[model samples]
Target: MDLEILNQEIDDDEAAYRVRVVRRVHYLTISRKPTAVLDIDTLCRPYLLIPKLPPFPDGNWTKMRISQAANGETEHVLSWDPLDGIHSLWHPRQVDVLSLKRTADHKARVKEVQFDGRILLSKVAIFEWWIPRLQRETEFYERISKDHCLGSGSVAPTFLGHIMEQERCVGFLLEKIDGRHPLLDDHPACEAALRKLHCIGWVHGDVNICNFLVHQSTGHVKLIDFEYAEPFEETKAQLELQKLKDEFSQMTER
Candidate 1:
């Protein structure tokens, strides 16, 4: 698919935000899955140099739309109508909207980002887009930092945030790890870290090679993401341990 960078505008109104981009994407067809392959390098640069977003029609500040691109087959390549506003944001796993209370967990910042299929790119680029969205809310990030730095301990970005809908599934954030080699596929450090988490009365349902991060400075490994963490009774520890063992076994087999 051919997606040309057109124009983007960010309308920030408290908790509501609308990011509109005007661009010509070639393959938004039924047989073809439309992909938004954003490059990290392209987004790294400051957005001030880009052209200002076209003014909204009828001067309705609450809603803004952009005419993306025009094609021979269609009028425009990709376009979105005026997005009204973001309503109440939901917690990842909280079933009752009334229970969408923010957590009081200390040590790391937590925020939500869009996890829909519309955003697509390399893994790195995909991460780059989602990271900022989590950090954009100043209040959320600052609160967690006051407690402790969350995520991969030794400088690698920690994923303390989540994207759960039915259950509380989110990830966290931490300082970026630098110049560190990840642990070998089979290493004791993996089990040790999970042990630490269990001791803290937390259970990580998913503990694979990808879930752990190594701190190069101290050779310490950190448990980064807690999306699957849940409180488990002692009686369930054995079951959970078996699950963890099974997960590790599968990783080793692969």
Candidate 2:
């Protein structure tokens, strides 16, 4: 869909602005100056367009434009601020837009996307709409990357980048690991990885077979889904550690 913001009329007394937006899709151009063209899929319904706006009380609207950067490639720079409420459209350069293929439909609405011709997974959490689970997961990945406690071989999928909405991180990108069939043979390595993470002052609060991925060829185990992970306390960590040990012992005995 091609959306063009023709012009904005602002009323300073009421602090409100009326915006005119023209929507065009399927090779249709709406306005004289169409700032952005969005190719949307019909299956993805109830499309949510979060506008990134500048700070409040600026009282200025920046028109969306595509300018040639030093690299000579055109960059889409869009900024919009409307008065009725706080509505701004801004897309950060660092955020990568993935083609969402599937949705988990859970509270967090975990999504699967194809990135760079490969299946990459993503999870989104709106700043105000949803709880802060996505943000927490992002933080965990960042900390793990910096601390380097978990060995590179056993680490979960690589953290790609964040998905931003309105200048805030609402989602994150992660490497998708295939062949995640559950196997008791991978239990020991998964336990070891969790132990390493705990030693770094964190605990994977939710630990199960599903969160452990076993590489079909190499048998390497990678721990994933750290949304429930939290800072480790000596007492609680010990209890959880023992529980994990018992679980693995039973699996091995079988």
Model 2 off-target regions past 4 Å?
Answer: 1-93, 96-108, 126-129, 149-151, 245-254
Highest TM-score against the true fold, candidate: 2
lDDT (10s digit) by residue, model 1, range 1-254: 12232222222211111232222111111111132122333332336312332322332232322222334221212333332211223323222211223333322233222233221111110111344333332223333344354444422243232322122222222333432434445356666766765665556655566666666566677654443455546756567567657766765576
Q: What TM-score does structure 2 among the candidates reach?
A: 0.55
Each candidate structure's TM-score, on Cα atoms with residue i matched to residue i, is 0.38, 0.55
lDDT of 2 by residue, 134-163 (tens): 556667876777776434464567777666
| Highest lDDT scorer | 2
lDDT of predicted model 2:
0.51
Clashes of each: 24, 6
What TM-score quantifies how close candidate 1 is to the native fold? 0.38
